[model samples]
Target chain A: MPNNALLLDGTKVAESIKETLKERIQALGEKGIVPCLATVLVGSDPSSATYVRMKGNACRRLGIGSRRVVLPENTTTEELVETIRELNEDPAVHGILLQHPVPASIDEREAFEAISIEKDVDGVTTLGYARTAFGLADFPSCTPAAILAIMKHYRIEAEGKHAVVIGRSPILGKPVSAMLLNENATVTTCHSRTRGLPDLVRLADIVVAAVGRPRFVQGDWLKPGAVVLDAGYNPGNVGDVDYEACLGKASAITPVPAGVGPVTIATLLKHTVEAAEKYGNR
Target chain B: MPNNALLLDGTKVAESIKETLKERIQALGEKGIVPCLATVLVGSDPSSATYVRMKGNACRRLGIGSRRVVLPENTTTEELVETIRELNEDPAVHGILLQHPVPASIDEREAFEAISIEKDVDGVTTLGYARTAFGLADFPSCTPAAILAIMKHYRIEAEGKHAVVIGRSPILGKPVSAMLLNENATVTTCHSRTRGLPDLVRLADIVVAAVGRPRFVQGDWLKPGAVVLDAGYNPGNVGDVDYEACLGKASAITPVPAGVGPVTIATLLKHTVEAAEKYGNR
Candidate 1:
């Protein structure tokens, strides 16, 4: 068997993006326009906490500023909304990110919508969702935007290509499908409710595994020479795809730890800089 | 060559649905609950006028009442919104249908959002869109809902099925994909920008053509025994799928003139009845 699994170097690509963004950030700083991110956490969820910290750390390395607002676990929706509104009015806050899987009590949608679209670097607002779905030139959700950026960097031709996305979460599946369609790629979305998983996988030229199930897509089911983007971030650093099985089948494949993960933060930083430029001009 | 074009009898199915709805209307009338639809036409476009007239005639035949509101082509967005607001507040109007593709001056989304979720019989409101996309058991866009109803009537199994939906229009592509996902079918959405249309079509066990292009899907691309649903209503009464080419390949296919057309009106009536029931209780 040919060593078909060409490793998709996401880390290297992300570094390049960060380098470009750094220059942009330096130029903005020279003009006295500081790009900043306001990360709001409404609980002590370990994963959410870590993710927020990583984002803050990334901002520091990029010469960007970040404001951390940690709320109690029992924070009400109203309180969360108030905090977001405050951030929306803050001149220094260029982008706002309310950590995902917020406390069960808070209506996450309502809170997300409260973020002014101008400051929504994470693209979690209703306006952001509408713009992205409608194919308007606007900020897209960071992860989905990162996926597109990654594809573009690798010169992966998406137009007319069969892209089977294995997840339907609002942030991932639906939005990404919309973005892919905007890029002229034929996009298919599958979820836990979907049937005949392997058959669909076998027909795809590109497979984006995002259902969060580790080793869900086996190697044998992959179409030979297919590019694989594993977006699943499970415990123990396992991807939704069985990378071991994909070794000799995939033409190009993203590794679980260093693949889509690094690019998401890079895109988030890029969006922050963009938000600052637009808002600073105003 | 076997005339493989198995006519998917949409008119017959719609007739059956109408008959069932007629009985329901009679039962509701006996209880002093009459289904009423409010039709709002913003302009004098011939196609819009004809559609509104057809809906009104359908209402009359079913003993469902309708209120027609005609506005000039130059009506301002605020003026149109006010009219819809009045209709939304009317207790006598059980359902609201605003003929779409309103004049360019009118902000269509703003007007659609004005309709109360309960009174949005056409299922174009944000609530309706969100509910449908999130797989909430709510009213769907009439045409897409009719497609699902037809599939159910035929006892077509969609679970784990590979369904390729061509077109990504908001009312059709996005919501239909979500509905199919809810039914456990893996759905791929292709649009004008999609690459490799023929290859994608061949992988589908179920094909839905909603891209307004007339007869774009060729017969040779279909998998043998695939269930084809043609939802395109283009000029000259043409459908998106090429019925002539698909005859022998598809196990079932909806015809252009009668297939999805009548079912759409029938489903709208059903929503009217549902609106009346819910309104009466309130």
Candidate 2:
């Protein structure tokens, strides 16, 4: 471990969040509404299967209900949308998570949008994304929202600070930057097309690496006292930030296994419970 | 005029767009589909009234249809939502533009959301904003989309460029930054809470001022050869950029009167016409 460098232990933070969620789940159970998350998987891709299992396991651990809808690889866009429409109509289903990269033949965006805005606890719909970008979202994308939660738990100040975000994906890069802007932080968004990426990274007070490239961000690129959050989960369990090199430089850094990944699922579970409560109230 | 600064002439560009739109409008007219834009004004505010009339004149000039829905200042949110719902369902009305700042008591977001996403020609709804931010919008917020039009007409390169956007409003600043990001520019978003704003500005290749403060961005803060787009239309017709001081420094700059403002209305008209064509097809 690098001297004077604080580790942002996401696993611990996520556990705390899950503990609070357990209490909420218990209260929800007393009221006769069990929060349900429906996971729709189109194909049996290994990684996708793993993610679905993880989410289902998390729900079970927290006493929330989870259902998996498995479809064949040849599912058409209309067929997939029909599946989601049924999930939307089910009163017991509070949230829907359509596992992404759903077969090359299917229109992913269309299926994501088919989930009712009220049941969009996964925050993938265009309406949800817009509200998230505009700071009006009750539940935002899990990974980005989890990043915010980690920052909050650590008491990291976003106001008047410069945060450099390396990615522009709809779920992570884009929404997280907007969230930082909502917190009064000066935000710079860089992608593969961005020029002089290192120069941009070097000036940031907070750096978020979400480009999905294995160790893409060099340690030397980090500013001396910068807070670093790595959201990339590339192969070999590596993160976007080069952990060893940046270990000595950063003020705080998140480890790959215990970092953004765990918090994401926790946030998803938390939002699903919240959605159930709202649905129950209605 | 300041020396060595190329004026980004919005009047000329907007005229070009309107001229193109006129032919499209004529084609739609030939098909028995008159492009119609409905402007809903909540009160008798002079500025809002002026905007409504200007839109009507633009529609008339291009052989499109225009209707003004003027509601009393005391209209409740429910009443405004009901009025928008009516306009949304009206087959003849192709686009809806609810003039903003309806009333303090009226929930502006609720009113904006009430406009059907299909007829959100003004691009104020959450769905429209999200589509725009995600680079999938048919009609984005007029002002930000116009900013892109200006850049495209001038051939200002955005790919791999550093663009500092000085504001975070939903309409102008936020959307413009997202637009730049879509074009592959490294984008930095600043606002009232930004620290050492001048230092950030000096490093930018493109500077966009949408902070709504007169001359908030100083001339000396801009780097030499930077392209400047000022979106601020403050009282006395001054812009966010200190136009006089930056005129000699920037490679290009827009004048307040003929800059972003004129192009905004033109873009709105163009989108309204496009929305009409889509509605006609349906």
Candidate 3:
């Protein structure tokens, strides 16, 4: 019944993860391995460009090598897949990240599958998905993994709790639900087609708002003591959950910009470092 | 609600599917393309052997070829994977089934992944799982696909319905939950870790009992007039749901022996014929 809800500061956690990765990167350097990440961007959409650049910045900040491959908007799926294959074969590239929302002309799933599972640091490949579902993940979907990392950092218990995950996007909603299930949380995955959505949301002990629609989940939809993790990064700095209203009801909440976003980038970089260490040892 | 719930007859449905596949097989026979399924069974587990035999019998009844590779109980993971690889490369083999519960000595996942996604008739491979999740499945996990087939045949509306899937096993609980979500059903997947299990189950319009524990899901857990699909095939013809109790409460229900079991074999055979047709054109 506390008036002030605890904030899950993802920026602070991401920074802490990056610091740990810096030491690991330096150790790899001593062994003649420069932990390298290759990022593929198919179009020039401003937001996608920003995300790609942000990832490059994170890699550089951790002393890891970064390669950005920007393809023309008219690039064919085969061409993009070929480029990823080259990255897969390159000894220096320990990890591969494909910027999402590729042009409509391209088959994104095909392109994602082309990234070698071994170097799938962004965890976009089907193989990685299966591994994550089975709890043997080497590189899980970054955003979901980041959310779990935040929860773990705060000692949040998922066991014997009901988690409502809105949206069913393969990388975010679906993967996160599986991750939560692996942690022993009863997971309900709701989408646009779900009926009585508010009723389902109210039953959750923990609510994760991942649907892209801005402020789609209202405060009154949540159980009073529910823990909220907002993974949406909508335009104008808004999230799926109305933060102002949720702050008054939820026990804990993650703010949009400073929450899942920063930690996602951190997880991608951390996986890159781990991939480098594994690939080097092999 | 009627006291007599309509039994979802899997044996009858399986027969109907097989009759349709029979003509397809005859057409392929004239074109010199004999649809062949290769089943790899490791160890002498009696139940596993029986299941494999049933699948082979189904294929034979449909005029499709079946190849059985029986590996020793002590077969190493590499050896079993090699067998699957050969089956994958064989031109005659249109489908591959690796009987479940492969001796504990083998890394089952590694063995399952070795079956090419093209020939994963039983839908045990990770690629098949990914495809099933994305709704572009060539061959989905047979048991789950069979459940959907039964639901569809009976005109059970999945869209906009709340579905509670009780279990999280890779082939059954997890895959079926994904299938339901793809059909636009709001899906809640629960297992032993779930809190307030009965309460969640009561909210569901459709309840899938796949937990494998005999009569684990009590009838009282279901909402009145809910449709129930019991996928567990335990000894003595017991199922995950307490069938005797559920019959009075459910609008429709699948009986233990005459339900998911027969339809599962039918789906495997159906996929085999489809795979042959696709592979032949290629």
Best by DockQ: 2
Q: If ranked by TM-score, best first, what sequence of candidates would result? A: 2, 3, 1
Estimate the overall C-alpha local distance difference test score of candidate 1: 0.86
What pairs collide in candidate 2? Answer: none
| Tens digits of lDDT, candidate 2, B25-88 | 8888789888889999998888778878888888888788898899999999999999999988
Docking class of 1: acceptable
* lDDT by candidate, in order shown: 0.86, 0.91, 0.91
lDDT of 3 by residue, B1-282 (tens): 448688999889888888889889989999999999998888899989988998888778778899999999999999998888888888999998899998888899999889888898888887778778878789989999999999988999899999999999989999999999999999999998887889999999999999889998888898999999999988888988999988999999999898988999889899999999999724
Can you write out model 2's per-residue Cα lDDT over A1-282, one digit (the tens) per residue? 456678999999899999888888889989988999999999889899999999999999889999999999999999999999999899889999999779999889889989998888878888898999889998899999999999999999999999999999998999999999999999999999988999899999999999999999998898898999999998889999999888899999999989999999999999999999888634
Q: What DockQ, on C-alphas, does every prediction get?
A: 0.48, 0.92, 0.82
TM-score of 3: 0.97
Identify the superior model by TM-score, candidate 1 or candidate 3.
3
Error of 3 at A126 (Å): 1.9
Candidate 2: CAPRI quality band: high
lDDT of 1 by residue, A1-282 (tens): 668587887898789999999788989999998899999998999999999999999999999999999999999999999999999899989999999989999999889879998988887765576567767635788888888888889999888788888897877877787787777777888888776778888878888888888888999888899999988899998988899889789999999889999999999999999999888834
